[model samples]
Target: MTSDALRVAAVDLGTNSFHMVIIEECREKGIVEIDRVKDMICIGRGSISTKMLDEKAMQSGIVALRNFLVLASQHGVAREHVIAFATSAIREAKNQDEFIRRVKDETGLKVKVISGKEEAEFIYYGVRNAVKLGSSCDLIFDIGGGSVEFVIADSHGVKLLESRKIGVARMFERFVLNDPISEHEIKLLEQFFAAELVSAAEKAVELGVKRGIASSGTAENIARMIRSLQGVESDVSLNNSIFTRREFNRLYRMVLPLRSSERRRMTGLDEKRVDLIVPGLILFDTIFRTFGLEEIVLSDSALREGMVLHYLQQHYDAGQNSDAPDIRRESVYELGFRCNWNRDHSEHVAMLCLQFFDQLIALHGLEQRYRELLEYAALLHNIGTFVSISSHHKHSQYIIMNGDLRGFSPSEKEIIGHVARYHRKSPPSEKHVQYSQLKQRDRNAVDVLSGILRIANGLERGHRQNIRELRLACNPDMITIGLRSHHEPDIEIWAAELLKSWLEAVLHRTIVFEPLHDA
Candidate 1:
């Protein structure tokens, strides 16, 4: 393994199951998941309503934690590097301390029963990395066995976070009386969710949360269930799929008629979650309708992934100043590093792109928010070369659109991908499906940013860091770009000259470049 590879594991002692994931953190190569192990212990199946973990459930939890510890050890993850977190079920248990002590005594492992607020925070951490939370406000919810967490956040940070004891298991124990869930039972369930989520609903509406994303098994099951109803096979990953309110309503209608066993036979419904699916859907539908969300995005990452990200932020990140203003920038470069990119060249291009963006602020008339997208696109513009050099621009666009680059919204990600797509090859056109899907404003931002990116890329054609500084002189009809370099920068000037046409077209100006030397 390269020197950057650091092995770490996160064990989530969830109420429904125990999951542990071992990951390889290569300084340059984002997150490489090495191994994952999970067991259906159902520690909160019957005890959630009682506010305690039954003795059998406690034993199952202990056994699962022990087995998970062995798996982590087998993967060479030191005990100290393993982060084990326990959520709602344990947190609400009167004997939670006893369980924590018992686990320590039996397996020499400590379990942290996190508060509801912290659990919400971790869910946000995990989902933000998987889904682009963009600049627009988003309501992210995760359904666990004993609780459901709701967070209202954006690209900047979380605005509101709350976790409630409204998990499917808890609802199943209290309401789900009929096999086909009688109308009365469904109403009670809806009422409970409505009352419990009133604060979350109001906060979401107050924050203008038109977008919603659901994480953990509940959302995944809903996405899969919707796909199954469309007569599609259950092999696809629903992580990136957008589940709209209309589709959710359709699935809600279709699934409510089936009994638990019949529902289990449907593809994509987890066997373990069969009994709890009804309450889960009710909760999902309640939130969708209550908040008036346009669609609900599914995030496969949840508490487990959240724990891992928190560990990396606290440990692996270097050169990040306190308060972490550049967390997103650092994350973008980390992905480039993972792709085995030319760090020096990518950094140089990013620097030059930012220079152009700063210098031509008057001409672009774009806000500073677009600056981050430009920087990320420039840094990752060439990572598609990892797949192939020829047609790498297209490949780069695909990778960036798919890559889990942190600190960008879905719209911003699309803009970045388009910017990277047009960085070298074809310019942005209506024919490009992904580019065409963007809103008009985002499309304009992509064109302007992509135009600058192409010219900056040309200035670094040699990848030798030959160009030192670029200064632009603009007039009503002509824009003169002056390049300052140490040596006779002939190759750089020639490459830049060839690519000036695209910038000239976008800016609607006659473009000229000249080499200037210091006396």
Candidate 2:
């Protein structure tokens, strides 16, 4: 926990499920997810059609919320900081006041029943950070139980936001009468969806939205099942994961006719979502067709993540400009900060690593993408010290491997961990189990990146940031690294001399370090 870090909990009381995400917000790091828990309480099960909360479902929601609050408290979130928002079901329920009063009286948690428009706005805030919205208009949507909120947005800001009443739970309760969903019901659903979606679809077309950002559990589950059908298995969240209309059509066709019992066994399809998935599949397929979307990218961050961001925006200036433009670098810096790293030394090493990487790119023969990895690895090379100073390099690797680093894929995270792990001690060898398991291409990247990191780390051995700047001269047989420092960097030079062998061996170049006193 960073000393000044504020831990907050955001709970989404949805129709089909209740989700709580514990987030730690740092002034510098933005929002980092600490832990999250979800319960399939199905709170809106009967409420969608009846417009009244079911007694049993209301009780289940209360219990789930109590548990969420307990977990939040265990994670050190203050009561005031634990914010819960009720969407769709509760908002539309006639007994909404009754449930809110009960929750407030029993658990002291004030459940704010937000409007569909507000929900869409919060969802926009959350997914915009998760996915790079770029400069073009993109349709962002969250399919809740009672309503599906939609937004048309770009890097500049949101241009349109609306919430429709065609949510999966609501549609399922109203239209789905068969296990496989009858053709008649399907036609009715299509007609109803078209009528309900005409305004949003027209707005999407008006905004020229060809790419859509899909959020919420419904989108994530669908994306996961689609990946599973394609034999792609990833433990990572579906956030920013892309699926083409062709791929989704393949899934929609394969899944739409399956019975509930058959659908339950589909890999990556949630057991709880077996029945709801039918309407969900139809809904997204309709969106693809109606909105003329080319592809949909998943954003696991939806209402819950949105709630937190909304809170932060209202109360603090922390996550405002920190998440969007260059999230990769921000995530790296946040991880290092959380580890209580020596910022000056780590930043100096990263600076030196970048300098070495840029000048020696020709020798390493690595693509420009690897340069970003090298810089992030250098920044977080010593974060294992957060666990212990002894064998901190190994700890650093473990941390990076499981650090919940944003804006990176699983393989990319592994590459970063391997680079940070090999920054010190022995160079990468066939004897290391993890290092050996990497693909040959990744292994080669690690070899070059870690080799560069080693010399860079050694250059700041004294941890004083004595070396102010660098100059690299590449010759056929030798690369001379020039250090500019106010005082003699004797220790740094000696350390670099000793540590130069790995990089030299990797690039097959002789290395030399010289001091430059002028500026």
Candidate 3:
């Protein structure tokens, strides 16, 4: 690989295993996956029900991640750029903190624990990039060891997202006690899954989603096993392929009578997943029947691919107007809409923030990266008002920290949250835990962006869009902001003056607000 080639790796610390893929992404060739590896750690095999990750599972996970790091280093991937995330098993485990600490201590890899909704969102991003669902709506499902994610979406955007704690490992540990699970157990499992999926299935039906897509290890194993049994030569590198309900039913029936030991000899089936296959098959069968789907397209691109695609979309050809792929300003605004925010006020504030950023770039000494974060902060600063008007800045920080804002790393998310949190009364300080936790550079970013956001928010204090444009005249001692508006803009100017102290302190210049036009 040349120096210019972008080599990145994504690690998914799943319940059943740890998966890592290295890819060299480029504009001309798109994403070229260089290598992929999976280790069957089964970290959730017996831990899901107990809510504890046993010592053996923790050690296995650490070893797996360490080995993955070695491979990534060998493939020329930068250590800091490697992305690693943990899913349901770790999220639900009581000893998760210990596991994370041990992994970091042994392997020097930071792991982000993501929520089920974020998991579903990432899955949607992966499928949207890999498979072409056209304009029609399609339901996508990913069954994991500790949970299952379902998403209803079209080519344009996702409509419905749901995730449940009804994964194969969890089901098998709870229901499958006998070899080739008993009919009573199967009946109980089916009832449980149907009850859990009732709301999502109804939503799918309401959306008129007839077609379906399935991803994750369980779906991939089933599709490959069925193909292998039908004398189809399995291609190791194949992904985003199609499989049918007929084929799934055939494999389900065939595996029903086989013991785990016998199933180990099956060509398509992964030996590690033999014990859990019965529950996996049962879960898929019930889902297919519930949704009235005859076929499902399979995407080998799961969450790991989703992370890589997000990274590429954010880094490649950034700021272009030609339909930025995933995680653009559109997605950020979509999140604001989901929170039922005041769109007019958020947009007006964001516009003013950007205008100020552009005009005083040299004074602030900030880059484009912080500018994007500022825009998001300005748009979502008032979202906490949905919770309560009093101390809404804190609420905004909480929301941004927890919300599913895609294409941002965990650190970046925290930075954005800090920026939004300081968009109001209190400025950044060493006493604020969130603000102080950031690195010095990030702390500086929060200070500068928050100062600008506060000024922008004040400029739109009336929420009437009275301030149409702003022109800044920068001098050594003071700066004059020329505001153009259709009204007197008294409230806007007063609010800005009140919040200009932080900006003035940071820039060492007094801010003076003046009206360019008065109607």
lDDT of each: 0.83, 0.86, 0.83
Q: RMSD to native for every prediction?
A: 4.5, 3.4, 20.1
lDDT of 2 at 247: 90
Candidate 1 least-lDDT 10 residues:
318-327
- Candidate 3 per-residue lDDT over residues 1-519, each given as its tens digit: 755568889999888888999987643334557899999898986798899998988888888889999999999999987999999999999989999999999989999999999999888877665565556789899999999999998767788989899989899888888886788998999999999999989998898988888888788888889889889767543354567789888888999888888999998788889987888998899988999999877776768888887766677652122322544354466567656799999989999999999999989888798898888888888888878899999998988876655445456778888989988888999997767779999998888889899999999999999899999999899999999997998999899989999988888999999999644
What are the models' TM-scores? 0.79, 0.87, 0.61
- Report the lDDT tens digits of candidate 1 across residue range 1-519: 566577788988888888888887765666767888888788876677677778998998899889888888888888988989998788888888998999999999988889999999988887776676667889999998888999999878889999998988888988887889899999999999999999988887777889888888878888888877888656645565676888889988988989887987888888999988889999988887899987877777778877887888788772222332444665687778767898899889999999999988999899998998898899999999999999998888888877766555556667888899998867888998777878999988998999889989999999999888998899989888898987788887788777777778888988888998897
**Cα lDDT tens digits for candidate 2, 1-519:** 769899989998888889899999877666888999989999888777788999998898899889988999999999999998988888888999999999999899998888889999889877776666677889888887788998998888888889998889899999988878889998999889888888888888778888988887788888888888878875666655688999998988899889998998888888998988888988888898999888888877777877887788788866655435465677788888778888888889999899888888777889888888988899899999999999999999999888767657567788999999988888899999989988899999999999989988988999988888889998888998888986799999888888889888877789998999773
Worst 10 contiguous positions by lDDT, candidate 3: 318-327
Task: For candidate 1, give the lDDT.
Answer: 0.83
For candidate 1, the clash count comes to: 4
**Backbone clashes in model 1, listed as residue pairs:** 28-337, 28-338, 29-338, 134-409
Using lDDT as the measure, the top candidate is 2
Residue 263 lDDT, candidate 1, scale 0-100:
87
Clashing pairs in 2: none
Off by over 4 Å in 3: 236-238, 315-519
